[model samples]
Target: MKNFIIICFLLLVGHQTVNAQKALRVYVVRHAEKLTGDPKEKDPELSPEGSERAQALAKELKGQKIDSIFSTNYKRTKLTGFPLADKIGISIKTYNPDQTKALATQLIENAKGKNILIVGHSNTVLEIIEAFGGEKPVKPLTDDDYDYLFTVTVKGKKVEVKTSRYGASHHTEGGEAKAMKSNK
Candidate 1:
């Protein structure tokens, strides 16, 4: 009877241990292109090309089971996430761009065992990825950078990061953006 009790105890402990390790998947990206030409504009909406790119992002991740979507409280970031949020039937939650560490903590604590997407600025995307214990890409994000997609996965204490691209290529030949034909 003692042997049976010991075996049962071990099984219960193992089960609890397995349950404690939460596996989380997060997709992070800088907001798509914003309207340019105004250095004083603190919160500009996305350009028309950026809008199309946002729609492409939605199409890219629509099949994935995204539980929550987060964005900075800016027109660009919000617009970047709106397409996906609308497709997933979830609302976009705003987080402080200056408080990446806090947001990372919140994600780890509350977003365990789920899938998440975060839209941020070029400066903040890497910071948020690092805060989540994931590796940043080799190339630093710049104002002109807009096509990198980062996937951060956390299982137990293990963190893995992968980088890829989505939507229109921001880096094209001759440093010229593909001319977006205006609807007007």
Candidate 2:
């Protein structure tokens, strides 16, 4: 009886360990700054600083074993997510804004326990966080605020959203996009 009890305890502990090992990470950020040109054109390309910020994003998530990359079907967003996708050898999958809720479910179902990087616009970033059981720090991102990084971590059913920053800020004259390291 003693031996059987010990074996059962070991099995229960091992099962818990395996379940706890599954961690899903979602790194979400807004599209980089765009050039001021062609007011009529809906999709503007990234500015020079935006390109630098993209590289910084790639550097930030370098070896995270990022399995999936997602972006809205737009020039600035795609450009921002490209470097990391290229570095990780994954294609950038585009999701329409209208179907973000569905996409959010698909991401959780498909990614399982891997890392995912999502590039979106200022308006949609908060929605994406809410989709993953994360509370939004701000209701909406302002046009000038491009320095927020929403790091969503999922372990089993528990989800945590930690606000962080990466790359240069889009608000500064220079110097890492001005306060790039801050969570603002």
lDDT (tens digit, per residue) of candidate 2 on 16-124:
7775668779999999888877888799999998898899999989978888888999999999999988888889999998788898777766666788998999989
Model 1 lDDT per residue over 39-82, tens place: 89999999998999899899889987999999989999999999
What is the lDDT of every predicted structure here?
0.87, 0.83
Number of clashes in model 1? 0
Clashing pairs in 1: none
Query: Which parts of model 2 have CA positions greater than 4 angstroms off?
Result: 1-21, 170-184
The worst-scoring run of ten residues by lDDT in candidate 2 lies at 171-180
lDDT of 2: 0.83
TM-score of 1: 0.83
